[model samples]
Target: MSALRRLSLSGLATATAIAGVGVSTAESAPPPEPARISDVQQAARAIQGMTLEEKVGQLFVLFAYGPDAHKPDTRNTTLYGVPTPAEVVAKYKPGGWIYFNGRGNVESPTQLATYSNQLQTAAINTGLHVPMMIATDQEQGVVVRIGPPATQFGGNMAHGATRNTADARTAAAITGRELKAMGIRQDYAPVADVNVNALNPVIGVRSFSSDPQLVSDMTVAQVQGYQRDAGIMATAKHFPGHGDTRDDSHTALPTINHTLEQWNTIDAPPFKAAIKAGIDSIMTAHIVVPSLDPSGDPATLSKPILTGVLRQQLGFKGLIITDGLEMAAVRQQYGDAEVAVRAIEAGVDQLLLPPAPDVQFNAVLDAVRSGRISEQRINESLLRILLMKLKNGVLFTPFVDPAKVATTVGTPASLATAQTIVDKSVTLVKNNANVVPLNADPRKILVTGWGVSTTQALAASLTKRGATTTVAQTGAAPSDAAIADAVAKAQLNDVTVVITQKAWDTTVTDKLAKQQKLVKDLLATGKTVIVVAVRDPYDIAYFDAAPTYLATYGYAAVSMESLAKVIYGETKPTGKLPVDIPVAGQPDTALYPFGHGLTW
Candidate 1:
C-alpha cells in the first residue's frame, strides 16, 4: 500500500474520534474511511465532468502579467504564446490563473485586493464558474512581495532567535490574514529547507534555522498558523532540501552530495514532520542529489526523489509543485518542451510559471493523446489539485470581496509590530573600551563610505538628526587620494565615523585595503575613528586601528538608522551576533567571538 493510504487510515480514526462517532459493538469495525476529499479533488471532479479541451484548459496556469513583463521573445510575442486571461477565456477556458505583478504602482494590501478581485472576475467570466487560485510569495522579511518595510513581517532567523513557536505561528497568521484579505488563497511560504550552510547565497535568513529539529518545529507552527488560524493553504518549499547546496538554483543547478542514509537522517526529517503536521502543499527544488538520483537531474525532474522519497517514503499526500521553470537552472539545462512532460510524469502535479506555456501545454496534451502519459496519471494529479482547493473552501465558491485587506496589510499597527521585532533582532557583535556613545558634539562630524552618500534615502534620515555629515563616494578600493582627503577632514573634526557598506560577496576587498590605510592615518592623529560595518560583521577583521567597531547585520535604511542611534547612546546595543564569525579561520582565535555584545 502507498504510504499515503496508511497515513489516511490513521487520520480516519482521529477524525472519527473527534467527531464522537463510535464503532458499533454488534459488528466488525466499519471499513476504513477514505481521507477527506481535498479541494484539488473537488476541482478535478468538476473538470472530469467537462470536455477534453476544458480538461486540458484546466491544466494550464497563465501568468497574471503578460510575457513581455518577463523577457522579450523572437516572435515579439510573449514566450507563453498563450493570450491574456481575458483573451484566453474568450477562446479556450483555462482551469486557473496565477498572478505575478498586478495593476499597482506600489503593492499594498488594498491594491492587491483590488487587483485580485478584478483577476477573479475575469476568470469567472470564462463561464467555468471556478474561483481561481491567487498566489504570491509572502515569505516575509527581506523577500516580502507585499507590505511595506515598516509593516513587513520578520524572517525565519528572527523567529529562531526568539525561539518562540507561538511568535512564529503568529507571524504566519499575520501573513495569511493579509493574503486572504487580498483574495489570495495560496501562500508559498514557511521555507522548510534547513539552513545548514552559512554560505548559502539565496536561502539565508529565509530559512528557520541551521538545526533540522528546530526547522521542523517552527515549520509545524507556521503551517498551523497559516492553515488553521488564517484559513489559507500553506506550502512547504524546495522539498528534498535546498539548504546545503552552494550554487543558487535561480542562476544554476545546484548539487547536494548527501548519501541516501544521510539524506534520511539530515535532510528528510523536516519534510517528514511537515507532512505529519498536515501541510497542504510541497514545492520541489531545482537541486540534484547525486546519491538519490545518479543522473544528477533536479529533484523537480527526478522520479526517485519526488515519487520514491517524497511520495513513498515521506508519505506526503498534499499537492506537489515545481519551482518556476523559468529559472536559469532549469531553462539552461532542460531546453525542450518534453522536459515539462517528464516533470509531470515524474510526479510533480503543478508546473509553476513555466517559461513557454503553449509549448508546455501542448506537450502535456500530446502526451495525454498518445500513450506516453496515462490518463490515470493526469487524473491522479488533477484530483489532488482539486482536493486542495476543496480543503481551502475555494472549489465551488464565487468571488468574494476581501474583508480585511486595507486594515492589516500596511497599517501603522503592523509597522509598529515590525519595528518591535527588528529592535529585538539587532545583535551587537563587539565593544572594546566602551568607546561608544560618542562624547563629541554633533556639529563637527565627518562620515565617509559607499552607501552613506549614494543612497539618498538613508542620508536624509541622518540629516534630520542635526548632524553635519560629509559623505565621500569611492570605488570598491578607495584610492590613496580619497583616503588622504577623508583623513584631512577627520583631523579637523571632533568625531569621525566611517560607514562602510559591504556587498553580498564582499566586493570591497581591494578598497578595504585602502580603507585600512586611511584608518591608521586618522588614528595616528589621535582622532576617535568609529568603523561601522553595515553589512556583515566579518568586515571588522580587516581593520586593526579603529578603536570602535560596530556591525548592523543588514544595510536596510531602518537598520542603518538604528545603528546610528546605538552609536550615539540614544539606544543601547542589545543585539548579539546571530552567526559565528571566526578570526583567521579559527573559532577559538576569533577577534570578536560569536555572541559578543556590549551595552553602554
Candidate 2:
C-alpha cells in the first residue's frame, strides 16, 4: 500500500476503533488525500516567491501584549525595557504574534474582538501585509485567557466529569466561536495530556483523564469541533504528553521515564489521535522523553523526537511549534543562539516567544550561511507555516473592521452561555448536615476565609441577595486572635462559612498547611462550619472535621460568583468533583474521588 493509503487507513481505523468497531478489509478503506494538489502547488509557488529574509521571518512567532487589560508582563519588554510590539514588528517582521495580555477585557466579548482587530491592523501596517497569525492560550476552564462570561467550558477536569466525547465537542465548539469572533485564528488548547500522575502539579486539572483512549477521543473531538465548526485552527499541546510527570516544565525540564513501548501505549495515544483528526499544529514540550531521544536534550531540540518520531513515524505534516523558548526549561539549559539553531535543525517550524529574537534570528541566519543549517530545511518549515495560513483563509484576505469584531465576538448571549456552563460545572460534595443553601435566616450568617478577600465580588453578590456576611482572612497560623475573630462572628451568627483559597504560585504547600490549621481551629469551636474549597479539591484532606465541604475547582471571578449563588439557593450546584481527593498519604484516593459530586 502507498504511504497515503496507509495513513488514511490508519486514521479511519483509529476512529472506528474509538467507536468500538473493526475495519474488515483494505478495499473498504479510503486513502488520505491532501488539499487539492493545485492548492499545495500554489502555496509552494508563493513560498518560492518569498525572499530568504521573509522565509526566515515566517519561522519566528513573537510575543506581544494583547489588547486585553489582564495580560501578563511579557518580561521581554516591561522587565527589561525592550522594544514594544510595534517596534518588534517593524524590526523583525515575525510570521506570527502571540498575545501576552492587555489585549482587551475578557469580561466583554465585544471588547475582545475590537482589541484583536486593532492589534492585527498594527501588524499588517508593518508592510508585511501578512495576516499575522494571532494566537492565545484559551484552554477553557481555569487557564482561560478570555473571561468566564465568554466561555463556560472550565478546564479539562471539568470536561472529563461528563465522560462524554460529545460534551467535549460542545465545549470546543463554544471555544472556537468565541476565539474566531475575537480575530484569533489559532488557539493553543485541548491539552492532550492524560492525568496519570496525581502529583502532577501543573497538568493536574488541565488534563482530561488518565485513560489513554478517552483522552484520545476527547482530544480529537475538541480539535475537530474547533476547526470544523468555528474555523479556528486548534493546536494539540505539550506534545509527547506532559501528564505523567510531577514537575512543571515552565520552571525546569521534566524527565519522562517511559520506554518506547510504554510511551506508544500511554503518552502517545492522544497526539496520534489528534494528528489523525487533522489538527492544524502540534506544540513540542520542553520535557525530555529519553525513550525517543536519549541525547538528553529536550524534545523541542531533538530530531529523533520531532522529525523521526512525530514527522516520519507519526506522519504529522502540520507545523511543529516549540513551547516558549523563554521558559526556564529551555533557557536555563541552553544558550539562546544555540537553542535557536538546534530547534530549527530538529525540524521545528516555529520558535515561540523567543527570549531574544535578534540573537536567535542572527544565530539561525549565521547557521544557514555557515552550512550548519540547510536552506532547504528553512524552506520546509516556511512552506508548512504558509500552508497553515492559507488553510485558515488568512493569507488572501485583508484585515476585518474592529467594529464588526464585537458583532462576531463574545455576545451577551455567549456570556450567558458561559454562565450556564459554570452553573452546571460547579459540583457539591459532602453535604452531610444539609448545610448548603444556608436555609437559615440571611441575618444569621458569617463568612470568613482567605478566599473571601480574593473573591469579594462573590461575597458582595451574596450580600445583595440578603445574606449577612462577615468576611475575614485566615492567618499563616491558627492563632487565638484569629480564632477569636472567627468564633466571635460565628457566635453572633447561626452558620459559619469558611472559604479556603489555594494560590497558583510555589507557596501552595505552605499556604495549604496554614489554611488546614485554620480550618481545624475554626471547626473546634463547635459551630456549624461549612468549608468551601475555592481551589483544587485536594485541599479537602486538611479539614475532614467539617460536615459540609464544597469544591468550586477554581477561583475565577465568575466561578466565585457561581459559588456564592449556589450557597444562597439562587443557583443549584450541579458540577461533580472532576478529580478524586484521596485521604492524606493514600496512593489511589485523590482528595475527592473523580466524578464525586451532588446536585441540588
Candidate 3:
C-alpha cells in the first residue's frame, strides 16, 4: 500500500472518534513518544509512503468546472470526462483548486464556503486524505474575483499613490480574512513588479510604483498582512518581474531585455524583500530575460532563471508556482503534455491552472517513470507543499463553517477601512481653474464614462450628496452618437466629470482616440470638464486638454465613493502619482512626473 493509504488508514478511526460520531475512542491508544514526530517528519514519512501517481498529483493546483462541487457540470463533461468536482478530485487528487471569477466558480460568500467544504470532504477522503490548498486571485481592486459582501480594497497602485504602507497592510489583512472565511487559504496577491515601462500592457495599476524601493516596502507590508495578520499564504507574483514589458503574457510571450545589472537594480528588490519578509510563494512570470538565461525560454520553463537565479541567488525557500499553464505564452512554447514536465524540471513546485490537468498529470507521472524526472525530485516539492499546508492550518482543520462567512466577510467596519484607503488614494492631478469643490447649489453634474456601472455608481453617489446628476454613458470606444449625446448633456450641465478607462493591456489606439474625441467635444461646449482616469492613469495623457483631472487607479465601488467625496468637496484629494504619466505618443517622456497632485 502507498504511504498516503497508510496515513489515511492510521488516522481514519482517530478522526471519526474526535467527531463523536458513535466511534469508540476506548479501542484506540496514543502513539508512543517517538512516533510523536514534528510536522516535517510526518510530511516526509507520508511522502515516503506515497505511490508514484500520488506523488505527482501533489504537484498540481488545478481548476475544475462547477458552482456546486457535488453537482454534475454538463458544460465540461467532455473535457473532464467527469460530471462533478468530487469526481475530478477522485481521479486527479490534485494538491489544490484555483478559483476564477470569470469561470463562475465564485457566486457568494456562503455559497463559496459550501463549495469549499464539499471539495475538502472529497479531497480528504481521497488518496492522501490531505486538505487541498483552496485559493483565488483576491488581489482586491479591479482584479477581485469575489465581489461585494466582501470589502473592496484599493489595488497596489492606489496604495503607492497614498504613499502609505499601513493601507497596504490593512487591505491585505482584510482581504486575507475574508478569503479565509470563504475557506480559501491562499491569495495570489501584492504584485511586486515595479512598473517602469509606461507602455507596459499588463502590470500597470496592478503594480505599486516605478520606484523599486516603494514596491519593495509595499510588497513586504502586504505579505505580513496576508500571512501574519490573517494567516493565509500570500503570493508575490511574476518573479524576476513582469512590469516593464510592452506585451501581456496571457496572449503573447513577452521578452524583458534588462541586463543582469539593470534587472538587479530595477526588478530584483521587491522579490528579494518579499523573501526576506517570509512570503509563502513567488509566482513565475512567462517572460524571457536573455541576460538571466540565454535559452530564450520563458521564466516559467527556464531552469537558469527558476533554479539558478530565483533559488540559488535569491535563496527563496518557499513554494515556486507557475502562472496559469493555459496562458498562450507557455502553451505556444510547448505542448500541453510537455509544459508541466518542463515546469517541474525547471524547479516549479506547483503547476497552476493547467489547460489539460489529466494530460499534464499523466505526463509528469510518465516523466518520473522514464527517468526524465526522478522520484526524489517529486518528493522535494511534495515536502514543500505539505509543509505549507501544515504551517497554514490546512492540514488538520480543512473544513470551514459556512454560517460564519457572512459576518466575517464584508463587515461594515471592513468596508469603512476600504473606503479610507481609496479616499486617501483619490489623486487630484489638476484643478486648472480651482473649479473643483464645486460651489454651485443644486449642482448640475454630467457623469459620463467608459463603464456604465462605474458611471451609474458615480451618478448615484453625487445624487445622494444633493447634486442633480445626468449620466450619459460613453463606452471605451464611444460612437459618434454617444459623443454627440454626451456633448449635448455637457452643455446643459455646470460641470462634466468624464471617467475614462484604458485597461492595462489596451493596445488599440482608435478606441482611446474616440474617447479622447468625446472629452475634447465636451471641452468645446465651454463646460467645466473634470477627467478621471479610473483604470490606468495614462488615459489623461491621451486627452490632456481637460482642465481638471483625477486618478482613482481603479473603478471599484469604494473607489467611486471616494471620488464622489473628492468631487463634492467633502474630502481633500491627497493621492500623488505612483507612476509618471507618459505623453500619449512618447513612451519615454513624462507629461506629468511622479508625485504630481493638486489639493484644495
Task: State the weakest 10-residue window (summed lDDT) of model 2.
Answer: 2-11
The per-residue C-alpha lDDT of model 2 at residue 274 equals: 98
* Model 2 agreement with the true structure over 1-600: per-residue lDDT tens digits: 422223224344343343232334435645554445565675666566566676788898876554442233465466224435555565676788776445433435566555555454454444444556878888876677776346555567666655667667877887887777666789998899877775677887777777788789889989988999888889898888888786788897899998889899989999999999999999999989989999899999999999999999999999899999988887766899999999999999999988877788889989998999988999889878877877886654323444455555556776665566565666788888787786636565677776534447566766777776667665434455776787777777777777775422233566655667667777887888888776556666766767888866666666667777778777787776555676766757665676678767
Each model's number of backbone clashes?
19, 25, 1
lDDT of 3 by residue, 416-435 (tens): 88898889998998788887
lDDT of 2 at 506: 32
Question: Could you give candidate 1's per-residue lDDT for residues 1-600 as a string of tens digits?
Answer: 222222223233333343233322222343354456654443444655655555556555555443222222333235534434455443445545555544222345565565555555455444554445667777875565664532455567656545667877877887787777766788888898876654466776677666687788889999999999999989898888998876889998889888888787777888888899999989999988998899878898989989988899788898888888878777766765867887887898887876776777778888888888887788777677666665675543423444545666656775565555555555555556566775536666677665643334344545666666666554446778887887888878766777664322333357546655665676677876777765545556656446677765445555556656766667776665544444533434656654566665
Model 3: CA > 4 A from native: 1-34, 503-506
Q: What is the TM-score of each candidate against the true structure?
A: 0.78, 0.84, 0.95
Scored by Cα lDDT, where does model 3 land? 0.85
**Residue 278 C-alpha lDDT in model 2:** 95
Whole-model lDDT, candidate 1? 0.65
lDDT of candidate 1 at residue 481, scale 0 to 100? 87
> Please, what is the whole-model Cα lDDT of each candidate in the order they appear?
0.65, 0.72, 0.85
